[model samples]
Target: MDVIKKKHWWQSDQLKWSVIGLLGLLVGYLVVLMYVQGEYLFAIMTLILSSAGLYIFANRKTYAWRYVYPGLAGMGLFVLFPLVCTIAIAFTNYSSTNQLTFERAQQVLMDRSYQAGKTYNFGLYPTGDEWQLALTDGEMGKHYLSDAFSFGGEQKLQLKETDALPGGERANLRIITQNRLALNQITAVLPDESKVIMSSLRQFSGTRPLYTLADDGLLTNNQSGVKYRQITIAVIISRSTPTEAGVMKNSVLVIPLLSARKTLRASLPTKGSRSLFSLSSSGPWSFRSSLWC
Candidate 1:
């Protein structure tokens, strides 16, 4: 009498289920890549090659070591290589300064805007994707009436008189104006690839995107008849005035610069009063100083 025969590994239902599950995952991944990246051809080719390799390995009679080498090599290159690269970057000063790929950093720094006479305060109204100024103030309670203008839209309302004061604690509100002028409690929203100017109380219309990104970097404002181009490493003010404007006029500005060196000297204000300036070479840099009265 013959002993009970054992079934081959390929005949096992568990093995079949595992293979089917793997194939489903592969198909799902391919579908996502195709929809998100629009790289259907590449995804299809990769899926076909991987599935063929998997099927060959599963059905092969001889456990050839060469068959495993290809899959192992691919895993090392795609999975392990990126992890190693990320760890390496974490040690270097690769932040907003150098961390941005050459093109991205240049774009970010170049997009910065500064105005000389415009005073921007909080409180704005949003009509669809456009924006309108709802309130303006300078010298604490000294309020000014200004009309709402739609940013990135063609609607401009005349400044009507209003006597509304923002009910809240009084603070310097320096950083808020510098980065973004939040409207009421809503976060400031910049149009895609466009930057807005925070104004001072001088009633100066701030600079805006005159040239679209499609125009290279030439900016022109037909309303003011101003035209300018992107300058290399230059602090060109978007809005300029003949006289000193703000409270911090002619004060020392310790502007931070991006550097690749491990240790970097802090920046000192070349023209303004002594103020604390900070920077992070590898990440997003911070610059802070007391508002000079």
Candidate 2:
């Protein structure tokens, strides 16, 4: 007869499965973030590898992976990832100035707002349970006031136009300057329907988005009314198949300081009997060529 051994409490199936599920969720979230950040290849690879890893760890029969897990992880992180990244980046049109994705480019253009109207000093005052804002310049031009509104846990405050401040109350210049960060978030609308944004510590002025994005991916300058076209060029060479004098072309975009130039370069490479790769293209643009002799 032999003595029986009991499994430790830490080795319970419930705890193990819970940890595995959490890891799966975390990996899913990271993949989503990577996809959103224009890392499509990395995100897809991470999803495939992580899902396989989690599946192997969760299943009882794959316990043999425990012996090789450390080595596999080390190789994947230090060796495989770099190699995959280099291969993936080789096919993309990624450069220092042309790094922004379409969405990020739109966001950057949208954030640029130009001051349109007069810049004025502002005030913030508390009235009962809410706050009101008052705007005026040293010239004592037409004064502006806001409705009493209470906002919670917000870093920026947008002012709603009110006919008048009930008690005509205004905070001192010291108080207004002290809450400069809160003042920075405020935007007011003018009679002409233009927006007013914080220009400085306490000054507010009318503004409009510098660039306007269109449905067809065109960007127009609000001030100059000049339209900029959005051009997309895609070249995909998924496999290196044997070709009999076939042409492969890639479009090149050379954007100068004030203009954009696109040039197309095509190469007709013939596969000889000796499996020699006679690949050549015009200009200095380079692409990876593989020969499967």
What digit string (tens of lDDT, one per residue) describes model 1 on residues 1-293?
98987999888979887977788697767766553443433455466556655555565563584567588657755887567657756764445554444356446544554443334454544444444454353654544333434333233234443576434333334633542433212322222222223344223334543333336664444445554433233322232222443422221111223322322233333534323332222233333233322
lDDT of 2 by residue, 1-293 (tens): 99988989898888898899899899989998776554666788788778878877788898999678768877887898889878865655455534555555557667888877678777667888778766765574566666666543334334444554446466677766776666666666554455677787667887788887778666667876655544332211222333465654322222211111222222224333212222235433433233321
TM-score of each candidate structure, all chains considered together: 0.30, 0.39
Instruction: Tell me how candidate 1 scores on lDDT.
Output: 0.44
Q: Positional deviation of 196 in candidate 2, in angstroms?
A: 2.2
Model 1, residue 247: distance off in Å is: 36
Q: After superposition, how far is residue 86 of candidate 2 from its true place, in Å?
A: 20
Model 1, position 147, has a per-residue lDDT of 40
Q: Note the residue pairs that clash in candidate 2.
A: none
Quantify all predictions' global Cα lDDT against the true fold. Answer: 0.44, 0.59
Which stretches of model 2 miss by more than 4 angstroms?
Answer: 1-98, 138-140, 153-186, 189-195, 233-293
Number of the top-ranking candidate, with lDDT as the measure: 2
